[model samples]
Target: MVSHGFSAIRYETEVKTNGLSSVLMAKCQGCHQKFKFETSPQLLNNRNKSKHYDVNVRAVWGSMATRGGLAHLNESLATLNSPGMSQQTYTTIEQEIGNMWGEVVEEDLLKAGAEERKIAMEKGQFHEGVPCITVICDGGGVKEHTNIHTMRLEGYANSKGTLPTQHVCYKNWDESSQAMESNIILEGFLKAET
Candidate 1:
């Protein structure tokens, strides 16, 4: 029998990976509404990008201070109404709940994550949460263009719901474990070839 909390998100998103910036479309599970966006680190670092943009990739995604579990971090904002959450104890939460705020069960999320990682590993998708860096080269199998760009965004199902602060994190990649393995994590973001 399925657990009481076993609920699946009924939503769809359009992830268009063919532009100067990636287009993010999140469908709300609760409201069945569509949310659209186009955010990038370059745009985030752009001072002009602010004042009008609600996202700052550099601030939330591309800094030493921005290392680790970005998806998990973003997931927290969904439950900001709660109390007693801190970065220092992030690992603790990651281990106990593993992004309950992200609208996924621990075990189900584990499998989905594994599927993503496997696909990335097999097809050079770069690991999830890796920083996307862009560089311009002059020669030697290089060109005068940026070489990387990685972005992370959390989508909602539109339905108003509650999320837990608890989480689960794995120190290393162990198929036997249900937490985020070390190999699955990188200190930076994933670079997009340009």
Candidate 2:
């Protein structure tokens, strides 16, 4: 009788790239067993139920943090002889970052409002059973008042030693920038009323 230890061995490799990181998947031809080797860890993207390479997210984040956009990122990648992501992928990541920023800003605003309310209550700063707080409004232009582009409103307790908290911000482009300050301030006050 003759015994054969193994019949044959064959394998195939597939590479998946996400920005700078890659996953190399190897499969056995005979047994169809697959194994994945990753160059970097993956992050779970809760918005789309997808996994993103950590390096990809980091690259996008670094670009945004420095006020750079997709073009700049691509330029840098090109300089390094690396393939860059498509515009669609950059936009998707940008949108995700914007959503996360909005959530964080909202949470901070709520906490600040609660703190202001507490301070007002402690200082007996109430009118007709309603808490009374003071708000500061500011507006700035790119160069002149005619070029006004952004407006900000902040709220603080009436008592001294209380820090101000940002409540609302508006960026105007459609209407005349001159009137943006008044309009945004009014809107901020109206929102605070509720």
* Top-TM-score structure, candidate number: 2
- RMSD for all candidates, in order, please: 23.0, 13.4
**What is candidate 1's lDDT per residue for 47-87, written digit by digit as tens?**
23322122332223332233445344445544664222244
Model 2 per-residue lDDT tens digits across residues 1-194: 12366534333454777667777776655667778888889889777886767887888888867756677888999999987977666656766776788899889988988898899999999988977787654545322222111121122233445543432223334566555676765776579767
Give the runs in model 1 whose Cα sits over 4 Å from its true position. Answer: 1-11, 18-20, 39-194
Query: How far does residue 45 in candidate 2 sit from its true spot (Å)?
Result: 2.4
Q: TM-score for each prediction?
A: 0.18, 0.62
Q: Relative to the true structure, how large is the alpha-carbon lDDT of every model? A: 0.37, 0.66
Q: Backbone clashes per model, in order?
A: 41, 0
